[model samples]
Target: MPQWWKEEIVYQIYPKSFQDSNHDGIGDIQGIIQKLDYLKDLGVTMLWICPIYCSPMDDNGYDIADYYQIHPDFGSMEDVDELIVKAKERDIKIIMDLVINHTSDEHAWFQEALKNPDSPYRQYYIFKEGQDNQPPTNWRSVFSGSVWEKVPHEDNMYYFHSFSKKQPDLNWENPQMREDIYRMINWWLDKGIAGFRVDAINFIKKDQSWQNGPVDGADGLSSCFEFTRNQPGIEVFFKELREKTFDIHHCMTVAEAVGVPYDQLSIFIGQDGCFSMMFDFNYSHIDITEHEEWFPLQNWTMQEYKEKLFLSQKEIFKTGWCGTFLENHDMQRSLNRLIRNPQERTPKAAKALGQMFMFLKGTPFIYQGEEIGTINNHRLSIHDFDDLNSHAQYRRALQEGYSEEEALDFVNRRSRDNTRSPMSWNSQLYAGFSDVQPWLTNNEYYQDINVAKQVNDPDSVLSYYKQMIALRQNPLYHQTLVYGDFISLESEEYVIAYMRQDDQQTILCIQNLQNKETHFPLSSKAQVLLSNDQVNIQNQQLKLSPYQATILLIE
Candidate 1:
């Protein structure tokens, strides 16, 4: 049951912001190749690069125009081949972002389908006849507005798009289309890439009955999630997808399954499951009331967050595995989200947060700038943002009668663009990400938090990440740390504690989730393995510092 991916530590690269070679102000394959040694030194065993396929840049590469060709902005096929070979040389495997749930409206198939109603490509996407001059169903797109877009010159015809209008949902019900997707996946696997981080995979299957769901928002359209996400009979498509592609090559697949419930974990990740693992957003989105709207933030306590995480861990333990992470391209930085006080978001706080998740009983994923403890960029204007979803949310807030300033503040606090800012490599011009201005603005604090500042500093967040990764990969505790059973530990209100245990040993991880000192009982036989701050222990009682993270081995 042991798998190589299970033991490997993954580092996710948002290529467009990672690095730029040739002074083009755009990050490309060559830019990534230049960072291989840096990743190797950081103790990363695998790299998950976001989509770099040919596209019109509608959804920042998620909307694929050509699955077979690399986007010119990223590089050519030869460059990608070089990247794979180079990464492999450094003991790092690369997994691409597989976005088969939808394709760019500019894709050849969509174009062909748009040009002729009778084209075979027409079946590749979902098209329906309008109902009384309205969309077939009142389903709201994930990005906002109606999920249907009227087709020009085609009488009463509309196409369904789950995310963006430029991104058309592929008809998974189409047998030929499914086979074509399988072939494309096999082609990538054959090219020597490891596998994929499947994007929007849960939305692939939809309700066969096109009926309007109960409207959940003032917009009168129901959240498409009710009818499209993790729908019934989705297992058939999942089974076929696995058997046809992933199983044949034995490639690692992690699905972005948003709406899957705990009771259904078995169908997605165990021996008979569809993927190797899946991301659980229950704890990650604790601050938000819903994934669709950004306003009216939900208040969450450390105890509540701990319970949500423990529940996910317990459920996933029964059926399959999970990918533990704090920040990614889609959300605000971990430091910003976890620490409420802007001044308290320091290197120590970042290390504390990183330590909380790194040693869990699952493969840990480090986002591109997370190792350096990057915080969210604070841009004042909405025009300074690039995420389409941010614009939609701003509009939604206005429609709900919020002031422009209030709406902008909500977007500032929750925008995906907060994490999409260019990665800070050095303190030089543009943070050494590019010779010219980056496509997105650099973080204002990049000068103080760039990788160059902490690469050699042993006390830095970057160094702490390297230490955690080394400990996980160390043969001394690899079996216990990588495959151990996760057990929630009883702790105080502001503390998140857990134990990773096996027959050989038990490792206890305790983190103070707030900026206040607390106390926890420690066993006399426990040996300190790691701590983000100085430890003060006396008479079986340990005094924890503000935002402290401690790992101990029980002998």
Candidate 2:
């Protein structure tokens, strides 16, 4: 593992909502510059900003129109250069979101591809002749509907899109296209940024045969992932990617690689692996379903959640590292997902959840508002939604006989919009995010949960995050926390206990996930290193308050 990357605590920023410096109702590079001290003080060493490239806003900037330029809404390339320099001054690193799986339809390459079938750029994207009047395949896009979009003025010709129609999938089978992507990545690295959080990189390789996949949905369309996800030969692309870019610069790379074979974990993150680490989604995906439908989601029992977390940790620790996170721009807030009971989702519980993951055997990532314990926005309507995936799911629910209210409830619970809401910096105008209206509404609870209210409070969730980060980066416990072996402890329902052991020390971390106080047996000698609540210790026993968590240094 790269020692620097392993020691990092990455903070993800959804650029459009993080902070609006120009008051244009959108966050920008300048906005990020304005908040560097805040992040530095929060104890994060790396910043992973989601796509801020030139785009048509399809998929919220994931659909890139220009790789070399920053989106105007995000400020000029000069602002980005300034951000890198400024961040360096504070000893922080910036990791860009590398999104080469697809490009916006408005991109010049795609536009040229549309004008003529024989254009040189045509080979840059996946375009094929349709069978009769139907699409070339039965695959469904991730955003919804058919994966293929017909070319205008062309007979039975279509282009494939794994996501939105406005975003056309790139043809990784084309060697020139791969070279182009590599060159673009190296160009960015030359600009002095740390590296990239590769987006949907696992989707780059496609099944050589483009045959239709088995139907798995009511729409008669097969999931594109069924045929293309983590397909064979994909590793070849990554190996080359690393050689041409990351390996040369010795930069950090965390891949968003879904459906990777468990046995092949070493190939993805080992010392000579393609990436420094890869995100493990098993824990965050507990509420999801295989059918891609939201309504039939399952709530994780404490055991189920713990099992998933343990498995991922154990597997990754064998050969390489993992990127541990409870929430990102794509998922609903962690507090709402982990603590289902509304009343149980308090700041104290949030702190416990944060502590549980930060000390695990991996790099911990804190999303923009995660440090402040942001919860899902429960009040939302179909009309107020902007996320294409959420809007598609809402329409699907209505067509499948769900009541309008029920469908809206599902959207409220599952929408990425829940995390896209502008950061609540202060209680004032636009939660101190902007002077004008934000692109999306600020969370209603922001008035009480804003950063200004918690930044100075000793007991705030923000403060607890600082404490946890400091502990993880603390010189005294650094080695044990980062390289220790994780051992799970047998405990009752609604309780999670684990130990991190290195050559000379054992750190026991315990948490009560429920609202009721629980009695825990103390089977060893220990001293408190950290705790979310006041604890009572009797003769070889521990009495833990509701949602309490503690890190104990076992003697």
Candidate 3:
């Protein structure tokens, strides 16, 4: 590997929502190809696209119908090849999603497995005979249902699904199945695509016996997080996959890892590693109450958020590489959800948060619309919801005693649909996404927040982000930002402060997360290179206005 991933700014593209090329109201490969220049000008180094593989779109392409083929809605194999060619020309590497934890029930392999009980394909899934009115295991699916769903055709038999029942778990225990997966991965890498963002990668390995899991959370169904996910034997499978596919291309693989223990960080991303890096979810997990099923209704304090994120950055710096991100297809936008008031959500706060994470000792992944302060929509009613996860959480909340209105608030605040909403391209009908109706409703804020306006405005959040990326990639800051050790400046509430330093220069970062002014002194005369707010500095210190931030280079 060329260590290219360490220095890259990864921009995530949700295909169906990114752009509509044919005015068919669906984003396709052609749409992506047309926007390569936009991404290049934005200074993005790599692209992490949500699954474009053949799928039912049940979970928005997470339910894969075919591993190697492009989804008809997106385009054909030829369009994919052209995208790779165009992206590479702009120095933009394309990273596809690898959703191998489960395959769509409609996939040929799964269909064949169901058709013939004696067939070799039968061993390609986790089908078990029911025992004494019990499921194959007591484990609950991540998506609010039972893990095992009965296969009515096969008397007394059931198959496992870690997510939706429409998506059946692949039998990773099957050697043949592993071989097939590797072959598909190699095929993509061979096409000159840079690498992959492996989805639900931790779920690929589980305890062989579907034994009872320990109840560790407030919600009744214990989080299979402890025992079922990232279980002991993952390294072997990852090593094999790496040697067979990723190693050949030196591909950047950022495993979508969540519950992997801090102690195991090095093992997964060591210098001699199983993956180039894995996403650090400490900030996200901070809100995960001791409840298994609830979608964390607890609001986070600013200091708590700071500590969780800083700890993960510090942990990765000590052990191995990590993926730095605030928003993704699966979560709400950071600017909207993280800030208290929309009025207080200034471009300064946006830029500072961008710089704080991007300069960490790892790769930074930017979710779509994060550049120009894309807030989640408030008009979506329960009936308007499309994300299955959001629906499941709403039902779970009602079951847990929240009123209908209360549950609705949870969905509006936390729905993945918040991020999954159609990308706002221009101030047109449906935000210039398409001429026809869109798969999901566009955020109404798109009227003022579209890309066309921000792309040209020097003071826009989009412009600040463009400047931030360029600064990180600058000849002076590139090495420090990519490889510098992270050191925390404080542990107090509502304040996140750190410094990134190499042999040449030391960069001081401070953010006033609260709505109160924060004052702190610095060591020497330092140039304020970046700020989420206007700066006023005096003798060795800086006064951060409410929700303000500053990035300084020491003399």
Alpha carbon lDDT of each predicted model? 0.91, 0.89, 0.82
TM-score of each: 0.99, 0.98, 0.96
- The weakest ten consecutive residues by lDDT in model 2 span 290-299
> Which residues of candidate 1, in runs, are more than 4 Å off?
none
Model 2 quality (TM-score): 0.98
Candidates ranked, most accurate by TM-score first: 1, 2, 3
Per-residue CA lDDT of candidate 3, range 1-555, in tens? 467788889999999998889878899889999888989999998999889999998899999888788998899999999998888888888999988888999999989999998889888888998888767666667777677899976677999888889989888889999999889889888888888898888888878876777654334565555555788888888788788888888888898887777888865787766788998876775555543344546677877787778778767767678888888998877776677687766666676566666666678888889888788887447989899988888887786778888889888877888998889989989998787889889987889888999998988889988888888899988888778878788735877788889888899877777677878887788897877677898776688787676789989
lDDT of 1 at 106: 96
Candidate 1 residue 228 C-alpha distance from true site, Å: 0.9
- What value does the lDDT take at residue 21 in candidate 3? 90
Order the candidates by lDDT, highest first.
Answer: 1, 2, 3
In the range 169-197, model 2's lDDT, one tens digit per residue, is: 89988889889888999999999999999
The runs of at least 3 residues in candidate 2 whose Cα sits more than 4 Å from the true structure, single-residue gaps closed, are none
Residues 190-274 of candidate 1: C-alpha lDDT, one tens digit per residue: 9999999999998999999999888777788788888889898989999999999999998999998875889988889988899
